[model samples]
Target chain A: MSKSILFGKTLAELNEICKQIGLPGFAGKQIAQWLYQKEVYSIAEMTNLSLKSRELLAQKYEVGLEAPIKVQVSADGTKKYLFQAKAGNFIETAMMPDNDRKTVCVSSQVGCKMGCLFCMTARQGFQSNLTAGEILNQYRSISEWAEITNLVYMGMGEPFDNIDEVLKSLEILTSDWGYALSPKRITVSTIGIIPGMKTFLEKSNCHLAVSMHTPFEEERKKLMPIEQVYSLEEVIEHIRAFDFGLQRRVSFEYIMFKGVNDTPRHVKELIRLLNGLRCRINLIRFHPIPDSPLQGSDDETIMEFKDTLNRKGIITTLRASRGQDIYAACGLLSTKELVKKQEKDY
Target chain B: MQSLNPVLITDSQPIANKAFLLQFNRTFIFKPGQIIGITTQKEIAPRLYSICSTPNDATVSILYTIKEDGVLTPQLSALKAGETIWITQPQGKFLFDGKPSWWIATGTGIAPFYSMFQSGQKPLKLIHGGRTQNDLYFHQEFQALTDYIKCCSQDSGNGIYAGRLTKYIDEQESLPPHINYYLCGSAEMVVDVRNLLIKKGAEYHQIITEIYF
Candidate 1:
């Protein structure tokens, strides 16, 4: 059997491994440097370690990074890269370049269990939860690894649903022993799983973006099933309780559905629900998927809605759609056809 | 963290293979199709279970199966009648509006539908899917319904459709397009049924789903 990969291990996990392997305690830091700081692809690349130690490490561990197997570049410079996840399942990552900022959208799970009505990923029906290694490998194995300035956990699955792996990936991305990226440059998006959201708020300093497509409870339940379990009222209350200082940010992602959620009533409710919260509203244009009944709100209606929110003291910005040609836009990332078939429990 | 309230198990019995119907004394009123968060201890994060009993019942019941690797279910299945368990107040918006609708479910996903049925709301049809004849819980209660259809994938018996539920839906000459369709199951089952319903001419709005995450 192949040994576990060392690339995704936190400093403490590496320390545990070092102790088990009978190496000096400080070797954990050295291994971390090679696996993360240097981004080495092999255990033998640690020339400072003794040959015996290197051989021992190689016997049980590999760097565990797999490069993207396919890439589809959009006409507008957005690139969608596909990587093989566990058990022959596939995941897509999008790299969008805009002037100086390069943002990479990474998936947290193989597919989504959250069956949001507007989501294409939900159609795939959740294959497996990606390990922290698989999650980080999407960032590390990409071609724009060096220049990528922003990371969003908004690709395929609900990041908070896989909270442990998502938190570990965040730690690896921001810790000094890992990639050491700023938490400000990272944003984790959730459809509002309360327990996971609370745990995330208490543990990480990264920005959070909630998928709040509508403000009304009934409408939101039709659009996103999570609203049924963790109501929008509860989610907002939790956010209100958390003290996100000036540096850390919180944002709501609203996908405008033509006739459903684009009306003035929704804007008023949005303002009322988020009255005292210090946050921004990211107004996203809905990207229609196959067999979807909903259509995106017209540009004029979206602009008007944004203006109403801005007038109400909420800092609302209209997010430009990207990678639509390659289906890398929001709610469009899915690998349904590539999922391995198994006898479903249902 | 949401505070949990202590409740005593009033009854616990196996309803099907690896599935159990657990009843606890009701402490709060709830809609027919609401869920409660359950845990063995105060400190542990609770898992949500759909209330399987009607609101009028003296005790609330929940249906669940033992997931071999789950943190809660194995312990939940081992509990006796007098033992204590912690649960949150009833919550969730998957309520069935007494409208003429089709209620579809699989395995323990039948909990919410059963709650609605026991609450005196009769669906236009109840299509239940299970792997075997033994997997169909509460079949006797549903057998009286005029449109109760049972689909067993692996086992075929009298009056049971000998295939997947989706197959039975696919073979339908024409599905009622006007009535609402409520689906509850794992993600795969819900997604598959929703897509099939849409393909068979049902509008997206007509199909409401509650997936087990």
Candidate 2:
């Protein structure tokens, strides 16, 4: 078996590992500085550690950062990189560059279980959850690592589904001993798994983004299966109760699917559902997928919908569609990489 | 964290191959298709299971297949009828709307469907998939339904389709685009079946899924 990965360890976990290896506890912080701050490629490059300590560490642990296997650049300069995850599975990470901002969207799992009608990732079903190291590697291993101004957990699998690792990655990114980045720059998205979402909201300081494709429960059930388990009403109730300070944000991601959910009724319900909640809604243009039953709402319909929400005092913004040519949709590229096979009985 | 209440098991018996039917005393009223999380110790995270019994049943029955390398199953399967089990409140809304629809399930995924059947909310048809004849859990009870199809991969005879449900669905010329298609199973199975139904002309909005992830 490969040596344990030391790259993803939290400061406390590192301290535990160091204590077990006969090294002073403070060496954990030193190792954190090298692994996170210095971004060393190998344990041998951690020169500050004594030769004996380095030998001990190298025998049992490796840096554990794997670079992307392939990269596809969009005409708009949005680059999508595919990384090999556990087993033979692959995960895609997209780095979208706008005028002064560079946002890296990272996937939390290899594929996904959230079977949203508009999502391409669900076709691959679920492969496995990516570790904190794997999650962070997307942000750190990319060529534009230094230029990343924001991180959004909206690439593939639901971030809250892999809550432990997602939280760990956020800690690594925001902790002083880690990247020392501000928590405001990070946002974790979910299809509303209540338990995991609650944990993320209570434990982490990062912003929360929920995929609320529709406001109605019956409509949402068909669009996203998670609604059957964790209803949007319950999710909203919890968010309404949680103390997300003035700085922390909770945003709803609404994917406009033509006549399906783009209507005055939806807008009215969205306002009623999100009544008194301090949050904004990001209206995303739906990307057409193969054999999809729905179509993206026309630009006119989407604009009117956004304007209606904004008129009702609900902050709404249109998310520009980027990387349309390079399978910019979160699951499209990774789904193409999947080898299709005939299904067998359970 | 869920507030777990200690409940005494009323019955424990092996149902299908490696699967067990565990029944515990009921404490609260819940919808037929709601699920409850169970564990031997409160400290350990409880695994959620669909309640196979009806909402008004005297006891809350759950169907579970023992995972050889699982954390909670080994402990749960070892408990006796009188042993205590900690459980969360009845949760989830994978409810049947008493509409004409098809309920598709495989293995222990049949629990919620069985709950609906027991609660008198019959699907137009109940299609269940399993590996063998024994895996067709509650088939005798489900037989009462006018349309019950069993797709068994490793079994023959006894009115069983000799393949997977996905193949059966694919072979269908067309499925009703208007009626609901309630799918309950593994994520892979749900995705495949949902996609196949979509390809066969069933509306995407017509398929409701409950994934055991």
lDDT of each: 0.88, 0.89
Model 1: share of real contacts kept: 0.54
Q: Indicate the docking level reached by candidate 1.
A: medium
lDDT of 1 at B210: 89
Q: Which residue pairs clash within candidate 2?
A: A258-A297
Q: What is the DockQ of the complex in model 1?
A: 0.64
Chain B TM-score for all candidates, comma-separated: 0.98, 0.98
Top-lDDT structure, candidate number: 2
DockQ (C-alpha based) per candidate is 0.64, 0.69
Which fraction of the native contacts appears in each prediction? 0.54, 0.65
Give the per-residue lDDT digits (tens) of candidate 2, residues A1-346: 6799998899999999999988877899999999899969998898988999999888899998899999999999999999987666788999999999999999999878877777889888888888899999999999999989999999889887778898899999999999999999999888888888888888889999999989999899888888888889999999999999999999999999988999999999999999999999999998889988889999999999999999999999999999998998888998898765535446
TM-score of each: 0.95, 0.96
- Model 2, range B36-144, lDDT digits (tens) per residue? 8888998886778999998788899999988886789988889999999999998888887877799999988899999888888898888899888799899998999
- In model 1, the Cα lDDT at residue A117 comes to 83
Q: Highest TM-score, which number?
A: 2
lDDT over C-alpha atoms for residue A218 of model 1: 79
